[model samples]
Target: MSGPSLYNHFRTKDEILEAVADSVSALVDLSMFEDARDWRTALHEWAVSYRAALRDHPNIVPVLARGPGRRPAALRLADAVYGAMVEAGWPPAQATSVGALMRYFIMGSALGSFAGGFVDDASAYDPADYPHLGQAHLLAEQQEKIDERAFEAGLTALLDGLALQYEQARATT
Candidate 1:
């Protein structure tokens, strides 16, 4: 209940943060891929799960962005994802890079987004000074749609690109 009591469980603030990060990471449901036929499925499931975890615990995004550190659950999650990629035919280095890329995308997306930040009022923008921003009024109204579509599009593109790379790698060897 008090700071000293917390210290009994966590020696330092960093420890508490790491624990929180691990707990959040633990939320990722890898079981969704129990019957996954390929790496793409595994990775996609991982991305969705991880993204949901980050979104649910946005306050822990900064801590997760700092890498897994010594967190057990985080490390295990990385290992499972990386192993899936490698088993799916990716070279070790490329698999690691894919993990890093996915993390960057997920963590960046989890941060505060400007989805509905635009002013919907017409008077907020001066047409003569900013002709292109004249239609900015529509942005706020469409923020949710825009954010959801953008995230789906970006995630699809990333997965598609990675799939292409995997194909290319398979062709080479």
Candidate 2:
């Protein structure tokens, strides 16, 4: 749409951003929580879905990173995740923490493309000055693969660590 067209629909940039963010949030997978899968599985599915939505709409990550705000879809997303976590026997506070930590990880991942940050020019990574970065120049070409792998790695680590904590918490309480 043209600038004037956008202005007619949205009074401010913030409104446009909010609308975009809400649409993205609506695309996130929430049905996983309704399944018989365990909490960890449900969380994995949901997070992957959420990340995919954000990754596809990275431009709105900044708005979403601002938190749920009063957006209906974002609030529903939060409510669903938190509710699933608590239903899995996680303490309410810990569930909140889980939701917060996940938002941090997912939104942070969406906020920046690690692969895109690298300079694609081979000359930029001199072996003499940056021996370890020999392959850095190739990162941009493999942006999607690299970013997806990194996100999965980080997500796995977070989930595994959370599992340990969940076990420990269960044992004590």
TM-score of each: 0.88, 0.94
CA lDDT scores, all candidates in order: 0.84, 0.93
For each of the candidates, give the backbone clash count: 0, 0
lDDT of 1 at 104: 94
Q: How does model 1 fare in lDDT?
A: 0.84
| Residue-level lDDT for 82 in candidate 2 | 96
Highest-scoring model, lDDT: 2
Q: What digit string (tens of lDDT, one per residue) describes model 1 on residues 11-43?
A: 899988899999999998877445656877777
Scored by TM-score, the top model is 2
Task: For candidate 2, write residues 114-149 as lDDT tens digits.
Answer: 999999899999999998999999999999999999
Q: How many residue-pair clashes does candidate 2 contain?
A: 0
TM-score of model 1 (CA atoms): 0.88
Q: For candidate 1, what's the RMSD?
A: 2.0
